[model samples]
Target: MKKKLLLVLSILLNSYLLSAQIFTVNNIQYNVISTNEVEIITYLGSDTNIEIPNTAESNNITYQVVKIKNGAFYQKGLTSASIPSSIVTIESGAFSSNQLTSVFISNGVLTIGSDAFSNNSLTSISLPNSITFIGDSAFANNVITNIDIPDNVISLGKYAFVSNLLETVVLGANLENIGESAFNNNSISEIVIPNKVTTIKKNAFSSNSIENITIGSGVTNIEEGAFLYNPVVNVTSLSTTPANLPLSAFDNNFNISLTIPENTSEVYANAGWVDFGSVNGETLELETFIIDEIEYSIINLGLRHVEIENYYGSSIDLVLPSEVVHEGSTYKITEIGDLVFKNKNLSSVILPNNLTRIGYDSFSHNNLLTITIPDNVYTIDSYAFKDNQLISVNLSSKVNYIGNEAFSENVLTNVLIPNDVKIIGNAAFYDNSIRTLTIGSSVQKIGSYAFHSNKITNVTIPDNVITISNLAFYGNKIKNLIIGNGLKTIGVSAFNNNLLRTVIIPENVKSIEYFAFDNNPVSEVFCKSSKPFLYNDLFANKNNIDLTIPADSYYAYNDSYWIGFKSITDGTDLIDTTINQIPGLLLISNHGTISNNLQEYVSLKIYNTKGQQVLNNNLNGIYIVVANDSLGNMVVKKMYVQ
Candidate 1:
């Protein structure tokens, strides 16, 4: 009898706490957990548009309204709602039966409960980066045009986006599961599952208009009807072994075309993949060849052309083959495809003598120390050698394009751009240690952020480039910069945050954007253009910049925004912004002398007043010496050399 009474008391206490947590404030009912924590349980007012406050005052206590409970806004007269960042969870059926056309999820939301936005009229929704779990039927029956799953999402619940009119679906990099009917009845055209996905549950992507799909290597299972009712035309698998694809997984779509890796054809063909239309691997007959004990997969573009896709086995110096023989047929290897040697610890690579092109990310994120591009190559695709320890690279004269971020984040000290290059793509050499760069004469443009945050001390842009895009040299240690005459525009923040002391703007430069030299220590400008276009804040923070204009146009510089500088002078005594702004005259002994402050050796020369060199020699106390280097940074001493 005593035990039964205690149980009944426990139940009654829970009931009392539940009642105490529920309260009404301004005709709106909320559920309170603590004195300072609450959730919107239901709306008692008749407001059509609601701006949910991040925090509220309740009975002299400040409460954070963190959640919208189940059925809180059901059948409400709400047309729009502004969720605050403090709200982390949207409970089941929270916004159902509302005439909502647009809903914004704030940045701190972590979970969307089951059916949270189901049956709503949302046309577009941007899932915040903090979203991790999307519950069942969370966004079903919407008109979402495109969806980009954030990288933090790990799982999609069953029927998550069912019946949506989604035209595009971009999967995140960390998604691991596709729950039952997750994307059913959509209009998605293509999908490339992230490399970490391990499963596709029942009918996950069914009833879609998907034309192509790429299954990542980590996928181990495709449950029955996972892709049912989709007219998938092509499938590509990055797996070396045949994955378990049940006959009903594809709904036995007989019109599918599948492409597996070179050696997995037989395993895929025997696993019911041959039933699909035109298995290319079964008929094309891939051939492998050995080069210095390393094996490579060569795809015959025809009898005369070939591509080396994947190479196995590593040597300190990898030497590719010029010709590959397979099945008694000879094909000349011509190109390297995407990610051909990515993530490898290769120290060096020797291209074939007849190689013509290297594709995207071909040698990215490797341990290569040096590379010599063949003379016949025409293109170096994006991310070709990014995130490496590469110290040296020799480009071929025939190359025309250096793609985006081609050699980013490397330790390269110098680069000699080939004379045939026409375009330098965005972020081509960002965050590198390239102290010396030689832009070729044939280049037409330097893309955005092309040399951002580099160690370059001096550079000379050739006359062929017409534009230097925004932030091209935003954060560098550059001391000297020479713009060519063919340039038409200098983009926004192009030369911000440098150690520049002088600038020479060519006569053909038509426009310069704001913050082009925001934080530079510019003292003089030799501008040749009489009335070149200049914008506000061109020299944002540094007020000591001096603009030296052409003799013919003093009014143009003194009247417009160019007058904001520290001073304006004539271009007749124009200054050159060389790194050797400070005189480096020093005293060195006749004996062997190392730098007293880790300085590099400067040139020792004696020159006559007519620009004629009288003597140039090593450090000796025999003659008065002058100094200059390639970067115009010299460590000179007034020592006589014998």
Candidate 2:
């Protein structure tokens, strides 16, 4: 009897534990553990006020109320309600189309689904700091006047707040990025995007009545259409110092004055000109932007007074005021701006005593017969002395940089470059009549077309020159070339149309750039060392010419490649005698045709004055008919009738 009693007690305890919080109405037991919360499933009547209980239980079994599913309370009567802290999530359309005056999102909730509060009567909202995300169209079509986003929210989905009656938008400091159309078509008059929020998505504020925007400084790139159709005016002055104004940053807007700060120099494509007027007068004042630690003044426009500080004129033998100081320290203007004297007719100019820099086009098109550039001058800007009748130019020892077209079209027979110059700009000496070129050893880069189309007959490139740009010596009458050992890159068309019969590229040359020696009459090439000199069409097709590459570089040659003639040194054992044999007698007929005269049974060898056989073959003697002047009369000679 005792064992049966213990078993009954155990069974009773198990049944009691299983029926915890079970509901019973009129003694009818109903399981409440699995029943969903009483979601205002569909409001039968337009009740003014509504409430949802935490639990609906008839028997003793409790369930956890987690969410209000979508459309649960569509068109409900409640003007506003505070969601209980136990609610963790709200599904899409849960409270949509309701007369919800406002929503108090408690801290326990994690998500608000799409259209959850859409088409509601909420005037504004302050999201709980614990909410992480709001889905698309969650608060769209609502009467929310302003929104204070939660600090913990990471992103806002597209159309999340579209058509809301918003006056100001305060983004969360912890927000990383915003999605497209997050706040479209709102009455957002002012917004302060935090520096931590790096991006503003496209169409985020489009068609809004946004009249003012203050972009933060930390943003790098403004993406396409970020602020499209905004009513903001005078955007440049919005920030004390705006950063990274990209191209079209201010497009499709109107502004009065654009004041580029002293710290800002680069104005990217069309960013500051939103239908701006042509030639807006400016008074630029920059400070402490010193190169080589020399302070200079840009402009000192007096207040409310238009001062034409400097005049650019076309005068002969013009002398600038000694008070003008540009670029560096000593009050002598060192540099001039672009097109300062582009088409002037200055014959002989004596620079001001303290003047240092000659700006771009300072003395271009001047028929200057002679000029003595002072030693204090350093930089000669582009086209400074171009298209002049300069028979001689004495550059100062302190001059370092010679700009492009500096001495082009001059009549200088010879020029001595000092060791201080490190670079020569493009077309610096083009069209000059200099017969000899002596580049300084300190010069490293020769710019494009530097000495092109000149009467230079010989050149000894300095060992320090590493790069020779394209067309450097094109159309030159150079008969001798002494390329330096340190030369590495020879640019395209460097020696085009030259009369060079032989060229010796030094062993230190690594790469010969494209078309470096094209259209030149270079008959022979001798590379000093076995290190390969890459020659692709270096000697393209002078059929009657000879090329003698290094003995070890014979493996780099192609038989069918049209390097027409070869003269390899005897030191190269790689030469196969059969392939090295000359074809036949090179009959130099008056018509310039190469042929052979041969008797099939007889073998003959023909050699020129250099002890190299021109033709060696067994053939019948061939006759190439040639017409020449014999005793002042036209005569035909069968010269090679062997």
Candidate 3:
């Protein structure tokens, strides 16, 4: 009838171009998408353990590979990837620059596009609740450490999981927005942020190592440098209308301890959000009142103070009441709010001599062996008494700030940092079995990894320490370090891996960075700087140490970092012949033999004027020898050991 309808429309346009053709079977490359589906498109397989198949026969017609197209396995040297509930959409730069450490992602993954799995070495990731949209830079620069974002994740695009060694993120409660620089530069120490997120974009969580942020009352547009360079000490914000941020969001952390919603703290202290620090609101109309059955709360009904907040009596040896009259109103408890006795298997509680604040994470993960920190506490906020089973604490000689990880992972065999502690935050007493640490002459900054991994054997940095930050006393068994004439910066790896053999660098030490005495076996340094002390690879064993400069300073230690010191001497006639032979060099004997002609005496402690430690040749009454010299020079004589 018209040439049989033009030959049946030319056989239905050649069966729709042979079902959108582009084929290849085992080494993957698919694209058919019709006669029974198929999408993958690239990966001419050199197999670094890939397994992404789910059906692909090609010309014999099998298909059903679903979608994975754009730049399919871009730069694939993928170490391990299984991804196959017929992968629903994984497009842009598919497995970007891979050396992927491990990825399973199977439940019909719905969308994970731009730079998908970017530059990988992924430590751990399993996001497939049929993932809803996670595009830009998908798992960027990954050594992923942890991630959970999949509760049907709704959009997370820009730089999605940027630079990841992310220590735990759980976002995605139908996440909504949160894009630019997505979880930027991770090591995210605690972040909650999920209540249908609502825009947190720019530099999303910038340079994180975020120490506790919680923010989610449907967030509401946080954006600029999102949580810039975080070290955010305890935030909380369930948004009782405080969102509009931008004082550069949270860079320069402003000493945080926020927590809101309840009387809203004067609308979050008039919206600058209390300019960052102590907010603490959360009162559901206050009036709690419970005494020995614990609860408390009243918060300042005109100075009748009160605040234990919650503990329904099951005493693992508890005892609190500094004042709790209640209906007839006496109150005066003073505060111990956040997570009141957390995980309270409290093996000794007793703290309320009108406790003046001990809030966030009050007695964290407890089984407290002994605490006693009540001198009207003056704030001991972050993880106050952290992960306890603490073998004796008693700190708070009116504690003037001792927050981040306050007494972290403890076994504390003695840690007295209380001369009204001025700032000893980050990892404050971290991983401790601290064998006698006492650093408090009003400690002025000793934060990062402060007393990290301790079993301290002499580290006297207290002359009002002016910053000894990064890795402060790193992995210590510090055999005498003593750098504090108000030390001015000695940060990166400060006293790293120590068993330090004599290092007294203090004439207001201006910057000693890098691996500050890295893995120390440092044999004698004693630099009381007459200037030139801006070091870097500080001293693993700079050609076997022995530095000692401060005479005419030997033209500031003849350069090249004290000429890689294995002898730079000139210590002003060895410090005026060791301070004029320390007034009769302690020669005691008569069987209590103490003798010290002082040839750089390393450690001789006799002690007994009731400071109890006698045995330097079995010393008796009024002793106190205390020698210590490989030039950190301290010869405290006073002997009468007869």
Candidate 4:
């Protein structure tokens, strides 16, 4: 009995020494113990056949087996590896550098670390459905011919399962993400990405010799150069209606044919793979239009194609066909499209009298110094002559309507807006160098920004005008504004930043748009009628000036915003009463004002030498004294003190 007990104690002591010794199994750290002749360490170095111990006691210690790590028998000398169901986590770097003919991971293993079983000589690997995460570099550079990732794995890390001799990679339905370069440089003839994968990183299967690719429907933004320079035979994105397939996403590939889905609307410019290629052996169509006996085509977005005939004159300076007459009338042939002659260096163009509407962007961006619009043309399209370096334009009075942005950014010094024009769109003359603008008496409406950002010093808005669009005269250097007697509404931001000294609001005008004259340097607004001129914070800064209102309208003006004003009945009396009445009026022009005391009524009329009333007003107060004989020119008048 004493000998047996001593022998048991000796065995225990030997197990302790063996367990304390650390050994590196294929570069993996492990502590083994040997007891009672039981092997504590197992070196499965590139072995093909690996069997988990069943009741194999080591060091007399009962070990709890948890997992059979990946590469546990990678490239091992053994021919087969049958993993037991007791494994849970296949730690990274485990089972590597082993020569294994076959690897069978049991279903009980839940996690597989990276690089496990990589560079293996195994003919096949059927991962069980128990794997949740295939770690980085797992099974990379392997000899696996085909792989179907189990539905249980959720993610695959970078280089995991890459560089394998895989002919087909069937990602499982449970896959959520494919790591970068996971399947790069692999012989994947075809791959059907799982719909569960939300992202496929860069170079993931980039250099793979894939003849077919099936992208899942879950992907939205295909990362830049994701599949660039690949030898993909047939790449089909699952998205039937690709929202934003970039221009260079799949460019530079060796694909035989591509079929754009039915729901796609726009195809990018360079998306056709090469610089110029026939779409199904047919050239892409573009918008084409004709003008002046010449066919113009706008190809590929902005390139203009023009084909000319030889029947026209080739004088080099002026080109006009010999037979300009087409119909019985003097009008010649006519056809014009948008931007027909835009950006051209043509020296001159002669339009026949039969010509009508000028097309949109017809003469835009041209360097022509002078242009003559024929009297037969009644319409001018938008941007017809915009941004042109023209010095003068002979606009025929026959032009009835002008479209939006017709003549913006031009160099015209003076402009005569025809009375036939009914509508003028926004920015029609914006940023132009026009000095004087004369609105014809027949004009009705003025569109937004008609004369904005121009160098106009004087403007005479016709009384028949109804609506003045926003910012009509904004950023102009105009010092004088003649508001017509029938003007009604003033649009927002109009007359902002002007250097006007005084402005007379006609009685017929109703609404004054917000910020119309907010920042104008005008000192006073002259009211010729009894009506009150509405004011808000827009006129808060100009509250100190004295507002001259008619005697009857003084109460209305005072109640609104005119805190300071001179109440007068007759227009002539104010000029004769004292010189103080003409405060800001003379600041612009020193023209002496005239008064008529004989006119007892509120109306005062000043006639010129032709006996015609050149100026008519009703306000009567201490007016600037001046003598007006037969002519309306100012004559010397006796000055009066207060």
Candidate 2 has a TM-score of: 0.43
State the local distance difference test value for candidate 2. Answer: 0.60
Looking at model 3, how many pairs of residues clash? 0
Better of 3 and 4 by lDDT: 3
- Best to worst by lDDT, what's the order? 1, 3, 2, 4
Q: Against the true structure, what is each candidate's TM-score? A: 0.45, 0.43, 0.35, 0.40
lDDT of 4 by residue, 1-642 (tens): 999999999998887777675444333234443332222134534223466642233334544456444334443334456666666777776666544447777788888788766644555788888888998888865557788888988998988976455677788898988888787654566777776677777667654446566777675445554553344556555554333443334422212234344443244222333222223333434333434545433322321212121122233244443223222222233334556677675556675455555666876876666778887666676798888776777778877667678888878888887776645666887887888888877665677898898888998888667567689899988898888875656778888888777777776454576788767766666776554445644443464444555543433454456553333333333422233232112211123544443211223334444444444344233334443322133333333322
The stretch of ten residues in a row with the least summed lDDT in candidate 3 is 575-584
Among all windows of 10 consecutive residues in model 2, the one with the lowest summed lDDT is 300-309
lDDT of 2 by residue, 1-642 (tens): 999999999988776655444443322223322344322233343333455444445344444455666776665544666676656777788787655776776677778888888866577787887788888889876657788888888778778997655788988877766667788656677666666566667667754546556555444445555655344543433333344443333323222234333443344223432222111234223332332222333322121111112334445776554443334333435344445555667777776555556766767887888877787766676688899999888888877667788899999888877776756878999998887677777776688999988888888898867567789999988988888765656778888888888878775554566677777777666665443433556655555455555543333333324234544542344333234232222344333233433222113344443445454333235532332221122223344433
Which candidate leads in lDDT?
1
Q: What lDDT does each candidate get?
A: 0.74, 0.60, 0.72, 0.59
Q: At residue 602, give the lDDT of candidate 1.
A: 37
RMSD (CA, Å), candidate 4 to true, equals: 35.0
| Model 3: pairs clashing at backbone N, Cα or C within 3 Å | none
Model 4 misplacement above 4 A:
1-293, 296-331, 345-347, 538-540, 564-642
Candidate scoring better on lDDT of 1 and 2: 1
Q: Give the per-residue lDDT digits (tens) of candidate 1, residues 1-642.
A: 999999999988887785477777765688876657789999886665677878767667778889889989876745577889999999998986555667888999998999988765566888899999889999876557699899999999999997666889998899999899999766688889877898889989865667798989888778887876555778888877656777666633334677778777788756555455446534434455665554554543333556666667656567787876666777777768678788887778888988876877988887888888888887787799999888888999988778789999888889899887867878998888888999999886788999998889998999977668899998989999988876756789999999988888886565678889888888877787654454558675435777777753443454445655555555454333333432222444445332221122235556434556564444344444455543455544444344
RMSD of each: 25.6, 30.4, 24.9, 35.0
Per-prediction tally of clashes? 7, 29, 0, 45
